[model samples]
Target: MDYDVVIVGASIGGCTAAILYGRAGLRVALLEKHRNIGTAKRLCGHFLLGRAQAPLQRLGLWDDMVATGAGTGDLSIRTEYGWTDRSRVDAPPFLNVRRTTLDPILRGRAAASGVDLLLGRTVTGQLTEGRRVTGVRARLLDGTEETHTGRLVVGADGYRSKVASLAGVPERFTPNGRAFFYTYYRNVRHTLPTPAVVWWNDRDWVVLGPTDGGLTEVAVMPAKDTLPPDLTDHAAYIERYVASLPDAPDLTRAERAAKVVIAPDYPLIRRHPVPAPGLALIGDAALTADPTPAPGCTWALLSGQWLADATAPALLAGDDPAAALRRYRRAHRAIEREHAFMRGDAEAGPPSAVQRLLREAAVHDPEVSRRLALVGMQVAPTTSLLNPALAARALLVRHRSRRRSAGRAGHAPAV
Candidate 1:
């Protein structure tokens, strides 16, 4: 093989994997479709939550990211009942930065760390030897073709990954009820208690946060029917959105930094754990939950690190990578458990009884609120919501609140 690893995509996930692979003394080739080094994802929430800390630190990017002027703060979410108090959350704070600045930093790190960065290269087909994937065939920007072979070919090209499609990866998609829109604003006031705030309701999920360059990104996920026919009038749309939610920041004085950008129509995607022999998939290429919460960025960084950790030793020892692939599959399934719940949430229309109860209880129960925030930040497993002790505490709080309401109603003056 010409290389030990050939990775498709050079975004955060791909760059992260390349950085790790190079660190492990492995020869790696990182391919990217875009030739521009400064290109950034325009339609993103860009909030790197608590879950992303581990991988960022392990990749030696914690301080570097902080140095990039990425805002650091905790997350506060509001449900219909009230704000899910994050005062009790002890996890590490999140980093908020735009992809414009973040992407180049990761890509630069990958190049400096000795990974072969192949830009303006598009993978058109996969190379298979017998029953296993061996490499990829690609088209160069200069109207030339090239074949890159590797012991392991990783498809990190994201949601509609050509590599996965070429490898015949099995995937499923669930329809989403929300239409997404995002834009940036200058002079936007920072929400209290930190860099970001999320408003979650059955009808909408809105996230607002400060990114680099003193601008704020507001991503809205309202019911498909709720959006107007013309989204070009961003101010009007944001005004209407603020009017609908409680305690939302007033963007009246904030100036629009650019035109509104509508997110691509995307359903919840889940691809098979192991796509093919000697081929691996990570980040959105493997699975994607509801985009309403903007969970893709966190998972992208994490899945890359997980793949590197699982397969590095095998590649170094000249052993079969299948066992390592199985380990990665297991790690992938662990996150799939969390994504499963998110998928159910996106398709289930509104919050069910349990979800409502949990959100309601979170308003008054600190522990419950903390756990809820952790899960929302993708730091905790969805199973944490099922803790018997925590559930019982939330249940008790709900019962008392109900009794108080009943007592007050009985004593109401004649009206």
Candidate 2:
């Protein structure tokens, strides 16, 4: 039987697309290369922001997520000297969930939404006629090759997407200069004020949060070459660094929960036109960037819903594939460009002097702290930081603080 849409890679992105399309009455075949549909990657931070809430609510998965023992709360960011905690305002509360628990739940929901699950199938290549993609050639677990035809083929496969390569789409590349190391531990202490915290030192950073069942998820992000062989060495480095800061909490008492896992955190990239004619790519296959802007669950849900919204109308209009694909491409680029600008100069070292000054100011002022939180979350644009008025204010605050310290010393502080 021919499907309206055949999606490769049954990840959050693929599953989401399948759920959306199937619910719209389209027959969708969602393929997973893995033998088990319930499997999940071990190295995710497992934190979801407000933007991810829309898709979950739309798909009726919010309650189920909570039912599955996910933590619902605000996210907090910690820099060298302080913490900024912001609760959900006019958005769904952020969720703390292990990917192992989350992915399988989402996959089950996608199946219930009418997606045909084709687990243990490797999509080897694409079936394209000239510039128009028509179907896929996949090899099943039993060593049998099958051809599945579809009006539209959605490539939701990850970073190394074969479908995108087969379609001859211009490859989008991201800078993978940093690596992330993480592990989950049980009975870990949450002595920090918030469940989620980002500790920024001069040259390194760590993001930690509580997962299900008293397990704490610790993620260490450092330059690819900077981290010690064990990654745990950075834990000691963080302790020494944090102790020097004013009012920093003691983390030495917290027991190490699990062995560290390390992976690269790359720069963001997007293909200008994700879908052309008869093929479309969604999620990481379509666009991906560093996790700094926190792109896991939100990116998946947004891209998935986007593909569904863009193509459902065309499919209903009798296989108007080209028009639908064009719409999908346009929508993807629009969102990608916006995210690219706000993700910050990740290439730059730690926080800038100016940023540090503003953060110091935020410690005393709630509004300033909230703005800082927005910046950290990448919810606000970079222009906010570069604004002349804000930059001047940060400078003034910094200068005055230096003057006060100098006066106490009975001399000007050396710059």
Candidate 3:
């Protein structure tokens, strides 16, 4: 084997995994199809929430990221009714940096950690022996084909992963029933001091975040049924939508920093066979949920770290690699499954009565708001909100609010 591990993508997950493996004294080949490893993805909000900070710090890149003009601020979510202020959580503020700036830092760290960073190469096929994947055949930009063998092959590619397909991994997808459109703006003043602000208006969702290089990212996800006829004219549509928000900044006052990018649809894709003999998957290649919540990047970073931690000992000891891979598969599924369920429920339909009650309760209850914030930041499991104590408090608050409304209306409260 030419290396201990071969990763198919150079995005956050792949690069992070490569760095860890390399640091563990194993040979790693980090392959990227793009000519430049630092190329910014066309359609990413590029906001790294509080959960990602620890990983960045562990990689010794947190200070570098901060030095590269990363901004930190609280998170605010506004609904049709009102805003949910979650800045009281003890967690660190979200890190907002452009992919253009962040990716280079990650790639540079991976390279420094002794990873064989291979850019401008596309993985054409996998090398397999019986049921085990052994390596990959890649073609460079110059049309030169090279084969790199490895003990394990990891697919950290995005949603449409070729590795997952070639590895025969089974996948199931649920349409999120919405499309995302976003663009960057320079010199636009925002209403909130937070790094990111999410507005939920009449079933439509909009996100605004300040990223590196003095640019503010404005993204929108409109329901499928409400999609505009001129989808191709993204700028016009984005402008109109942003302007229509109650307290949104005027896009006309700022210079359009980038071309508008649209993801026509976001389907929740889950790869069933996450691990097989000598093969594993991470990032979007493993599971993808609705991007409306902006958990993709954080999950990507965490998945890479988890996989590396689980497999490093086995890979270093020359033991049965399947054991480590299996552990990774189990952990990945558990963490991702919970997140997927929550994300699916949020996107499946409008908020249910209980969900609305919780949201309203969060506005008035500090503990409930903190719990909601923790879940939103991916620092706590979704089940935390459903604890018996919290549920009872929420119910009590809901009952009181209803009773108060009835009293003001000069009517008796219902039983």
- By TM-score, the best candidate is 1
Candidate 1 lDDT (Cα, whole model)?
Answer: 0.83
Candidate 3 clash pair list: none
In model 1, which regions exceed 4 Å deviation? Answer: 228-232, 405-415
**Over 4 Å off, model 2:** 85-92, 229-252, 264-269, 272-275, 338-344, 348-350, 383-389, 392-415
Question: What are the lDDT figures for the candidates, one per model?
Answer: 0.83, 0.71, 0.82
TM-score of each: 0.94, 0.86, 0.93
Please, what's the RMSD in Å of model 3? 2.2
Tell me the tens digit of each residue's lDDT in model 1 across 38-121: 777666667787888888898888888888777777778789998876668776678888888888888988998899999899
Better candidate number, 1 or 3, judged by TM-score:
1
TM-score ranking of the models: 1, 3, 2
| Residue-wise C-alpha lDDT for candidate 3, range 162-235, written one tens digit per residue | 89888888888887877888888989876674667877776678988877787888888887778857567888
**Which wins on TM-score, candidate 1 or candidate 2?**
1
Question: What is the C-alpha lDDT profile of model 2 across 1-415, one tens digit per residue?
Answer: 4788999988888988899898899888998888886789665677777667768889898888877777776566566556643433222357778788888888888889988988888999888778778889999889998888898888888767788878767865656556666666555544566656666655566676766666766666665666566645655655555455444455565666655565655656665445556788887777775765566567777888888998888886776667776777776765576566534545535666677777665544455566666655445544566677776766665567677779998999766
Q: What TM-score does prediction 1 earn?
A: 0.94
Task: For residue 289, give model 1's deviation from the true position in Å.
Answer: 2.5
- The CA-based lDDT of model 3 is what? 0.82
lDDT minimum window of 10 residues, candidate 2: 84-93
